[model samples]
Target: MCSLAPHPFLSLSKPFTKRTLISLRNVIRDSALNKPGILADSSASPSRDAAVLIPFCNVNDVPGILFEVRGKTLRSHSGEISFPGGRIDSTDKSFLAGALRETREELGISPNRVEVLGELGPTEVNLRGNMRVWPYVAFVHGHQINEKGTLDTPLSSIDLEDVWKHRSLEEVASVFHLPLQALASPVRLKASKFRGGWPYWAVDVSDLVEAEKVEHGDGEFVDEVGCGQEGRIEIWGLTGWYLSLLTRILQIHS
Candidate 1:
């Protein structure tokens, strides 16, 4: 007892020692935050760094994409269906890290498990102010939902399996039910000379059917065209830009 009391201050590091394990974890986290590089896109504002992860998996044995409906509490694009992502953190190693971290936080996905395919085009939005959004694609072969019935507070989830998988162009047409025609692809994007700082870019959906027909064919693949605000397909705004990029990728892949 006397020997034990004398040596009380000295002890072997025990398994799962709180201090040692916690300190090790912190070291790993710190290292990860220090990596990543800058963007080549001048449109990408370093002052307001952000990124988003668009995840896809095999559904109905076909590629299925994941989109999130933003929470109504969000300032601008509240309740809009989109990808999972947020602003870049000082601790983030790079844009990719920021995106992965945001996805894990928002959707309870393990970042390590995401096989990053690569980065896609970036979209800029003027929401109350200005934002530069970078999108990355990743393949999630395996996913597990937490105790909850779904992952996080899903605004709504749609499985493309029976709903849309392998459906003919006729099915696509019937779903949106918008007028289809061969309209010249609208110059969807334009850039203006920067008089002072960054150059400004403009996007217009003046030609919706034309854009859709660029891939779907002349009223052959699609059923209808959404018009005014009542239509299911919105051809203007940030969502439109995202759809444009997605269409391009799909066309190339197909």
Candidate 2:
């Protein structure tokens, strides 16, 4: 795996699997050891049970993180960019188990097939402390195509299992693996005010998967933001905050 400190990337740097991805894994593992069995930002107890997995993977030797576009009909956070996870059930052995279960349900990637790296610092779901979400970092085996038609991950690792099998217009619209090269770029994510009040991060879907090396379907564009829609697709709010924390650990993005 590649080893390098934080630095500015010009274009898509090298394959992240051969670059910073390994470094990030090491950092997350070390951080977990330094902390407790699970990571939380505050000691206050939450009233609800929910967890999310910040899944990482080496798709065809290129490293990236997995994300999902929630179906527009979900009870909460509909049509938003999110990780593969949901409410922790009463039968779940732990928060990690809930996270893995959701991952299996959302992407069809089995639990045993993933290597859990560690836990990311948990955050309050509503900023009011009533509900908190514990996020896990892991390496999963699979690939997927984004809405704009970029086959970032092989549809079945190109064959074994179709990662998009669970997708439906009312559930998970699409899955995407945001490459580390664009992730490491300064311009990849921009800080902006959401709803004219909350400060958050936003990235144009085009800039995220626009590298010439990105494979596309016969001149298909790489922008998932404008799917004939009027608004932008942002990695902001809770998802964006966690990403900020992850990038800081990898020391790749400012």
Candidate 3:
């Protein structure tokens, strides 16, 4: 039971406007409220719970989502591409607080700059522990940037480097963004399978999502994420599954 998707967002030619953002916020808020959490049953208790922010940004007027490449220095999951988040802290007031705190720590984007929209859930099982992941959807906001790279004009495109100052090399290796439109374009789709042993939709987003101030090389991303295309970021596994849920919720076929 899902309706036809991709039609509603097929013609998003123009840059993301204030009105468009408002519409998206409403949709996310409403849809999120109705969706059930992945762990509705109390049969099991995970060793750890983590919170992540699925941050959406408008780049050069186009809607896109941001991702991070983890530094190799980390103990676990090093050199991986994922969202800005980590294990929930004891001091955090709520799951949203943990997500916002992680965002600020990893991306330099403050909680005030992001409009928290909603959340999603999916758990992970590993030898270390069974973990529950809570993903909060948010819109990153910033001052206007003109061609001259000043904040004098209305909102246009935000140079992420300008906003990303606190992200450390020890924690995050690089930051990139994948355009929303590119995800739905048939030409960009690639044949692939999920780690869970089923057909999965994959998209090569090398051209649209460029890394800024990243320390790693392009070739390593393929190894880290098992991308079929060389030097390109492929949306697969959990990332693609999350995108699929969002697409279905928004009725955007991909």
Candidate 4:
């Protein structure tokens, strides 16, 4: 059974207090961070495992985030958009450890190079009617990678110049709002099902969620809800929920 405890996510309406922001600054100052050896198993019923890294790099004087489109060849969550992390391995001492490990494996991110900024609460899921999931968050410094001396490398060597570009938090927020407003719109609720099943929704302007059909200018397709705006960041599913909360907190502080 799932726990009744509520998870805490970052809000966008208000910026963090000076003290809180300072705390985050302090976390980034840490001298050493450990790495997890490998990722964990995803088999069995309601098991606890999985960690994801919200990797960020400073490019052209702005923070740019790294996300992945899982290769369609994968067995689970194929071709979905997500962070560079995965399931907790037996070697992982903790959830944070697992997250860093998976990120390193998938995106060639080094655990030691990433400074932890704390984690958001976990999200639970039953994959394929089995495999329980727990998702956690961590912030990383935005810096560039040197080909020879850099701390990481691309696992797939696939081109990411288009999606992995520098985007201001404000731009990200504007894109986010386009969907939050829609979620409140009656049109969305009519399509949303009960909690017993899946949470289906989309944001046309920045439809990040996978369930919702992101309009790609080819004329809207059926069963696919147009994400109002064209070519905007699509926010949906777990990533959408996480972004929504993060934006709320950042906005509150800013």
Candidate that scores best on lDDT:
3
**TM-score winner, 2 or 3:** 3
Runs with alpha carbons beyond 4 Å of true place in candidate 2 = 1-25, 32-45, 142-161, 193-200, 206-230
Q: lDDT per residue, candidate 1, 38-57, as tens digits?
A: 33244544458678876654
lDDT of 2 by residue, 102-168 (tens): 8888777778667677777635454555677778887775443221223232222222226667544
Instruction: Flag the better candidate by lDDT, 2 or 3.
Output: 3
Best by TM-score: 3
lDDT assessment of candidate 3: 0.64
**lDDT values for all models:** 0.43, 0.61, 0.64, 0.41
Candidate 3: regions farther than 4 A off: 1-11, 32-34, 37-44, 121-129, 144-156, 191-199, 208-232
TM-score of each: 0.47, 0.70, 0.74, 0.50
Q: Quick one: how many clashes does candidate 1 have?
A: 8
Expressed as tens digits, the lDDT of each residue in 1-254 for candidate 4 is 11122112221222222233345444333312212222222233454567766543333322234455554345665545566666777999987788877766555546655655555433444434344344444434333222232222221222234233422221121111122223333333222222335333332333343333445678875323223324443435555444433432333210
Error of 4 at 79 (Å): 1.2
